[model samples]
Target: METHDSLLARIAPAPGQCSRTILDPATGTPVGEAPVHTVEDLEAAVAAAAAAQPAWAALGHDARSAALLKAADAVERSAEELARLLSREQGKPLNGPNARFEVGACAAWLRATATTPLDPETVVDDGETRAELHYRPIGVVGAIGPWNWPMMITTWQIAPALRMGNTVVVKPSEYTPLSVLALTAVINEELPEGLLTVISGGPDVGEALASHPAIGKVMFTGSTATGKAIIRSSADTVKRLTLELGGNDAGIVLPDADPKAIAQDLFWGAFINTGQTCAALKRLYVHDSLYDAVCEELAAVAAAMPMGNGLDENNVLGPLQNQQQYDILARLVDAARDAGARILLGGNPDPGQPGNFYPTTLVADIDNNNPLVTEEQFGPALPIIRYTTIDQAIAMANALDVGLGASVWSPDVSAAREVAARLQAGTVWINKHGAVDPRIPFGGAKQSGYGLEFGTEGLKALGQPQIINGWTATQTRATPN
Candidate 1:
């Protein structure tokens, strides 16, 4: 395993700025330090990507795909080492359904993206007229990745851009930049110099990248407020953007769903990654008939699962990645409790604990207006609201301004499919929550931000369409001469 010191060296902060300590969220201890980059450093990285992009684009899909496949191999080889760093920094358990899973996913996504192709299409073909549409790479993609699932999300943003022929300057979330930088180093070994680079810092670096004149596009994953700021910043350049912003994803359980059978799936759906996921089942609306049983079964399942330091292999969950998020969750839970919401399990914070540990909390009987239900907690807490009718449930689910993902749970697949179709989310699942496939496209609808990620549509979003038309020689001569 690479030492924290060695990994720290991989991050490039600006020359004058001091390094910032990265904490192990599992123990609240110092994991390593990441450099705090300045606007100048961000600009330099952008410039380097801009310089390398044309050549990268010239290499075409075959060569770029080959390089990405090699990077995937490196990621697989370093999976163990990267998973440990990921566990410490990102606060996900090292095994089971957490850090290792994310590492494996990173490699899988890279391979999938490497194989996915965007071939030019003939829009029109006749004897005298022929038009072809080509997906051309946009230069210098500034990828600002979020802290939650940093490795996989970063891979989601950059791999496609790189595979589609654009060079990237990535600035990972300050709280979880270590694993990203480390993973970047592994991928960089197979990539050309300046083709992919990492700049570690806070909002300033992100702002600089978003507003920079030379950056052709900005691909961001975070809050809606921040996404809007990026939109405003990118206006001057009219840069292409893919913003996968905040999601208050809702999961509706039909009266027909067997509460006992779906209990485990429901528990993991909401609490996976300690409920830090953007598309995690945040608010659950259950038909009133199954509401109490669903709550009881979900609470039982959640209570049985172990939550502790992420390094322990037996633990399935870990701490919140940072204090800011922890406090936000704490306040929301407190407000819900004060409003007479029944806390089925794990509502309070363990203030004496070394880590930012909030137990897997489930609140029952909360109305749609409850703060916990209304806001995006983005932590290990779920508010289970009871609804009398499917119409009511659907109405409540779509009421939120953000719509990244939603799910319908029922025994009848056909019935579930009917309900799923009405969901306002980008990705709606039946009997499942946040299952994403490389072959399927995923993105937000409404205020959750625009553009798709994953699949062919996602690959196409990283590029611009250029149409070439062939005209008859006689027609051209008559017009010109």
Candidate 2:
């Protein structure tokens, strides 16, 4: 089959056609284009992954480890080029922590999954009989990733699948297809054919991939609405699934917290990646004692932030991925202000800036009933609500349906730990925010979606348990007697 030249690829295809374009969010230019795969393309990719899985699974741990290590090397070598493309495609900070952190996640996850063995062991060892357990690879895995974390999240899905000896078919978000392809290209150079594959396109392709009969499992990271849709579509086949969905992660600023520290943590937690992160901080509940100080500190930082194209080295804030988000963010801010919330610092679009970039907007006095409080604003806006008591603060924080992640701001370690225990979330940080570990599981509870990614949990997510009957020669002799 002939492949189209990358330069001539179309962004969006005509109705049924499989084509797409990559928008440079910085200047509103066509950065690049790639094929928008169709339902048929989804079928083909699924078929390819299904057919390739058995052989890949048979390779055992050592061979797979070598491939993963090679892929890690490739990623490290291409980090610069990948970061540039990611920054342009995703409109993130030019060579800053976000891009570098993503690349580091890829390297870390791949190497860790490959090197760490998901060893199956013997369960019972009686004198008469023994039972041993073994893990077999689940068949083809369908991975649907999100735009907020196109590259790193995909690696979380793909690396573990490969490590567990499974083949993968990835469906990346349309907005940031280039980074996924770039990552895939690196893997293709290191791994064998069909071990990993990528299909980029729109919603139909995603539905097709989700419903494909050959796909044994699906690991999805997107919104709760779409995760529900995926669950419904795959109900007929009963495909094994792991969904890491939406989040309205709240941060609790205790009476004992420092204002300046809370302000800086709040800035990065909410404003990082222009607030296009699922786990980004959206809600803040502050104790009345420190509420005024926290508000002032957050506004002081927000006022100092410089918004510009991600390509600019000096830029700290970049564009929101699309126009709908731009409008929604602005509207949310306005609604919060209209609903009696105090506008501490930011509340509008920066008229002088190019692209869909918005300033780091901060609002205060928002209540749980407000839409800004309930919904996930995937932008650089943080709503701070004051609470008179710790009980009131916890109550307000738990009001949202999403329980993806939460952070507690307190100078007291014991208090932070106590709060972290009761908070309804998959992961919670104490006195620190957005801290993640590769060796630990990362995911959410409630409407945030079920299942985990990374570490031993990720490997377990891709395996099937089996009992092997065994008996030593002496045990067999004794049983005969």
Candidate 3:
């Protein structure tokens, strides 16, 4: 029953604590004040989670799953309030696959994680020997989330961790802490105290969390640089790490694809969340036969999508979440322009604009090695590169060090799948891009990240594995004889 203001007030910083005011990215106005917890606060939270984990784990899988189901219901009950807060704090629109979609995804992931079965597996069952593999809770898990898709990604980390019987301490990004705090507040209503906590702190707190001896695992989703830092910090403790790092995902359109038919999906795949997603298509490779037609159709789609204040229901696309991101996008686009890339739809923005509103830009006829193509421009701008053959497209897609996700678009599913297999990424789609399902396992390859997330494999990643090996009844009987 909480309204948007009531929800913000509920998670507001307590009196006398250091706090920072989060601003609406669309208007640069105040959204809410988030508590700035320190390293000491993070240590205390980890300690509390370690203390509370034993009893929570002892409740058994069924009991823990039932609790998660309740938490999912709690999320659904306050969906609207949470969506509004997320929209304002993250600068994603209220409709589309933005605010409301993110909130819904949270609830769906919770339910999926709660219900996905992960029973102990019998690895060996001969007459002379029997062995079963089981997963036990990893005392306390540290979840470091990104500003983009804050609530949904937070749930992606915590739901499976909690379901696997681990208590979680979350550290949201400095840019969007209010959304995470508000989300945790709603889920905590159905759980025991200290089982989950959010430490809205800076890098020092994150470093402490990664290195803290009490934490058994850390789930991080952010840039490659930060992921590498976490790896170094956790080396001493050897903490289990699941890192979904930066991705410059590429999409390949075969010669046979109907440009107009696939235009809308391609546009959203890149521009969703204003192109801030880690797995969104950043650079595209189109066969030379279809390049011009595809570019025209994509430009038409991007031009029609409204970009403005998130609060306005009519606007499906909003501003960049922060000034830093806007500046990065502007610089990359300018560089592309100077390099003689064709600006198909938009490449210009008014400097006088109040918010960080970079126009939905599509740079065509760009070189494969341009900064806009090679770098991760995590904004609403995509570069289209032309390829003469399938081998060239595959080579271009696999050239990057980071391979989180990729896609191959064609009318022939068989042909697309063949090309998809050649791409170097954790997951690849045929004719669609960035359509992640909770039931499927998602992760990164090479420098993108090491661990897998989602589905049963994801649940297993959050826990410790043990093999229960012993003699079978036949062996005991023979020994007695």
lDDT of 2 by residue, 1-481 (tens): 1121231232233465555667877778876666677777778877888888888889898998889999999888877667667777888876445676788778888898888767778688877678888878999999999887688989989998888889999999988887888788877789888778888878998998888888889999988999999999999999999999999998898888899977777788877777888888888888888888888988898888787777688877778878788888888888888889887776767677778877777888777778787878889888887889888878878877789999998879899889888899999987666667768899898999998887887788888778888777775344553
Task: List the candidates' TM-scores in order.
Answer: 0.96, 0.93, 0.98
Q: Count the backbone clashes (under 3 Å) in each candidate.
A: 0, 6, 0
Better of 1 and 2 by TM-score: 1
Once all C-alphas are superposed, what RMSD does model 1 give against the true structure? Answer: 1.8
Residues 418-463, candidate 1, lDDT per residue (tens digit)? Answer: 9999999999988888989998999999999999999899999999
lDDT of 1: 0.90
Give all candidates' CA lDDT scores: 0.90, 0.82, 0.95
Model 1: pairs clashing at backbone N, Cα or C within 3 Å: none
Clashes of 1: 0
Check candidate 2 and list the clashing pairs: 10-20, 11-20, 11-21, 18-36, 19-36, 319-357
- Give me the runs in candidate 3 sitting further than 4 Å from their true place: 476-481
